[model samples]
Target: MLKNKNIILGVCGSIAAYKSAFLVRLLVKAGANIKVILTPDGANFITPLTLATLSKNPVYTQYFDEETGVWSNHVELGLWADLILIAPISANTLAKLATGICDNLLTAVYLSAKCPVYVAPAMDLDMWKHETTQTNIHQIQSFGNLIIEPGDGELASGLYGAGRMAEPEEIISFLDHAIKHSMPLYGKKVMVTAGPTYEAIDPVRFIGNHSSGKMGFALADELARLGASVTLIAGPTAQKENQILTRIDILSAQEMLNACTSIFSEMDITIMCAAVADYRPKVIANQKIKKQADSLVLELEKTVDILATLGKSKKANQILVGFALETHDEENYAKGKLAQKNLDMVVLNSLNDKGAGFKSDTNKITIFNKALECTVFEMKSKTAVAKDICTAILKILK
Candidate 1:
């Protein structure tokens, strides 16, 4: 359930800090990408090399390197994480957190995190039973932080009470259950098509377009990140594939059609972002054509309308989205496609707008639903555009 998730493991100073090694091992084994942060005292308890080797990432201990002087931006780290768990949170760290202290990298990240925060407190029985500790825990919990209650066991001081950090296995199980239950798209199956299809004219040549497949790939990644089981149908492109999705690679429009048609009925949502060729060579030449003639011509035939065909087979609960790239009369053309292809919404981008077309890193888009409600968006990175599109899809799904 945790596959491809970005998680932060914060280790604090405590005897229970040894347990964090097992926690990191289990999380990584579950296919989660982990970055570790160790408090100054936490480092004295555990070696950074051990955590680094197990997580396959560099461990963060201080705010900056003395020689290199490179600062660790806690805000970026906070925003990058999907979830942050501070294991073996010491009494000192716990008190600091409750009082809004930013004395350490881990506490700084906790305060700045945009994602959910979890803390596992560990201390001796006397400290754990103290009124001050209880108050600190309650204060942090009131701020929307999840507290993993410590287990009752023998403490490091040879005293037994409820102050040991939860077992690593128990922690993992709780997170697994929590993550799935909170995901909006946890059980939905989504399909997205991207890139440009090529039609072969001969063994040596083919017809294609300039689509780089960045937009479609971005959508697929975003959907998967939101907990959807995504199946990506990609035409020939140089785009890098993101992990955590089922991707089918094809070169021709016909191959893409076959792939989508076979699985369309089972999909809850479908996004057609591919720039499929409208026409293809009428016949494939047996051999490469020589440069004998000054002028040459090949008959063109209309290719199968993959999006329109899928639109025809869509069920009532299925949400269908289409894309339109135009240079003139964009809205009309996009609305026409929305109606003609039975789409729930159409994302329209115009070539007339700079940085918004084939092979660009950025785009400007407007969305039109069947009701003809138009929502225009400013030029943004493809990633942000994908987020806007996902938000629109969520509204339609609701």
Candidate 2:
């Protein structure tokens, strides 16, 4: 869940400050972009050089560097992070945080942060049980900060009690669960179809479109980003995804239909985005046809409509979306498909418009909802287009 996330790791003064190094390494290994902010006292427990090397970013100790004359913009740092985590938070820092103290860069960044803040407290058993410290923790929580409760174990004070910082692995798992549950599409299951399905006529001959599966891949990635469990069913294509998702590969339209129908009933949302072959050769030659004839004639038959088949079985709670790639009368045709196929929405694309067709990175789309409400968008990169489409879907979900 932390993949590609911008995270600020705050290390405060505590013997547990040493564990921040392991946390930084784990976060980086999980594909997070890490920036370490070390308190002055934290530096005594763990050197800035050690964290800098582990995080692969320059560690921030003070707000300003006297020798280099460079200033670290606390507000910018705060805004850049998706989340801020304070590990090994000391009683002193906890008190400072609850009272809005901004004496250090870490506190200043916390105050300026617009994103979620998480803290893992580490102190002696007496300090953890102290009334003042508990009050401070309550105040911080009242302000919307989350606390990863300290564990029960031996502390630096040589007394065993509930004051040990959470282990690095535990902290990571906590963050992942917290972040995943907070997402808008959490627990939703989505299915997307992409690319062009090929219809085989002979061993060496087949028919397929020029779809690159860029838009479909982008949509799957976007849905996954929103925390939806996405299964991408793709036709023959070289397209790849950045996010990890369940992917099923197929070549023919029949294969695509079988795949979609087998799982369509279980999907909360199904997007039919593949450019499937409308017609296929009626007869398939067992072996390659020899070039012995001057001309050849092949009869064609309509391929099974995967979208309509799924639409027939779609539950009222399930959303079914289809795409219409047209050369003319795009809006009417898209609206027709939306109603005729029992689709919740139809995304229209016009091949007549430059940069809006198969194999292109850019596209112009017009979305028609079940109510026939139309939303037209300008030509944009497929990635941005995917976001727009996902936003529309979210409105319906809401």
Candidate 3:
């Protein structure tokens, strides 16, 4: 997505400045034309020569060069960029950005830039948690600047917490998503369901499947980054936010149905990304059932069929996508479901394929459409897979 794009990378003072070198490398490898702007304090952590060498361009460190009597035009630099990424954005720099303090070249260019601006904050855990820092963060976000959240781990100060900058690879992924915001679906409303439904059997036990919810959450973030207002009906899982998400929590298959049914009509697109249970125990024990010598016999009943229900009520222009995670005869099963459930498209994932199912970060998908056409994708990160899925949706929209 960064192909042939002009990228301005702003480095700020922090121990994480060293990661900027890797970030530059990643951007360059992704085909972005690079420009580097280094704050004076950032020079303390990483040398201008180092960034210059990696970027294959002169690193702009000051407003004017004293010996050469030449000025670096912040306005021209700003206008040249397709996106400006500020890594290791300290609390001080963030505050300046929030309040329009253009005391330095980086800040000046940020103020002048018309392109999308993204900040990856790096600071001490305490500073990140402080009210002032949070306010600055919120202020920047309110202005539509993307704030890639810092991760949690050991900090330079030897205090372990959530102040470390996200990895270079993660930053590149977000940048790619941010750059693809021109699609019409960018501001459309997309509703999705993901993960496995847990049918309660007792206080201590429940019946559930091995659904990671990775594909659904990935699709949600991908759609959001494309400018879609996404509402994710997520089942029980440990998934974290890859982008801003309006997550509606659900437990059982019935609850999942209730959530999706409530919002399905208002959505422009609905992707049934969940692995909802087919059945639940007829009777859920109020307390944990003790271990017994005798074999137990519990009754089961059908759970609500969310996708089919939505399809029955779907509007003419609304797109409804479904997923079929199958163990056998995947293509046949998926195509049948596509017809039966009235899905515009069905993504089929075969557990038979290594690394293509449940709980893994990677997945291979075969999209079977109503037109009787199918497209298969190679195993990739759920994030990239999401891009392909969104591309398919866009094709239908067109």
Cα-based RMSD of the predictions, in order? 4.4, 1.0, 14.1
Kindly list the per-residue Cα lDDT of model 2 for residues 128-205, writing each as its tens digit: 999999999999999999999999998898999999999999999999999999988889999999999999889998
lDDT of 1 by residue, 1-398 (tens): 67877999999889888999999999999999999999999998999999999999999998998998989989999999999999989999999989999988998888889898888889998999899999999999899888888999988899988899999998998888788778788899999999999999998899999999999999998898788999999998888766489999999999999999999999999999999999999999989988899998999999999999999999999999999999999898999998899999999999999999899999999999989999999999999999999999999878
Q: Rank the candidates by lDDT, best first.
A: 2, 1, 3
Which scores better on lDDT, 2 or 3?
2
**Relative to the true structure, how large is the alpha-carbon lDDT of every model?**
0.92, 0.95, 0.91
The list of candidate 3 runs beyond 4 A from truth reads 1-58, 61-183
Q: On TM-score, who's better, 2 or 3?
A: 2
Ranking by TM-score: 2, 1, 3
Q: Model 1: runs farther than 4 Å from truth?
A: 1-13, 21-82, 90-114, 123-143, 149-164, 167-177
The candidate that wins on lDDT is 2
| RMSD over all Cα atoms, model 3 | 14.1
> What TM-score does candidate 3 reach?
0.61
Error of 3 at 52 (Å): 12
Between 1 and 3, whose TM-score is larger? 1
Q: Can you tell me which runs of candidate 2 are displaced by over 4 Å?
A: none
> Which one wins on TM-score?
2
Residue 62, model 2, lDDT: 96
lDDT of 2 at 246: 98
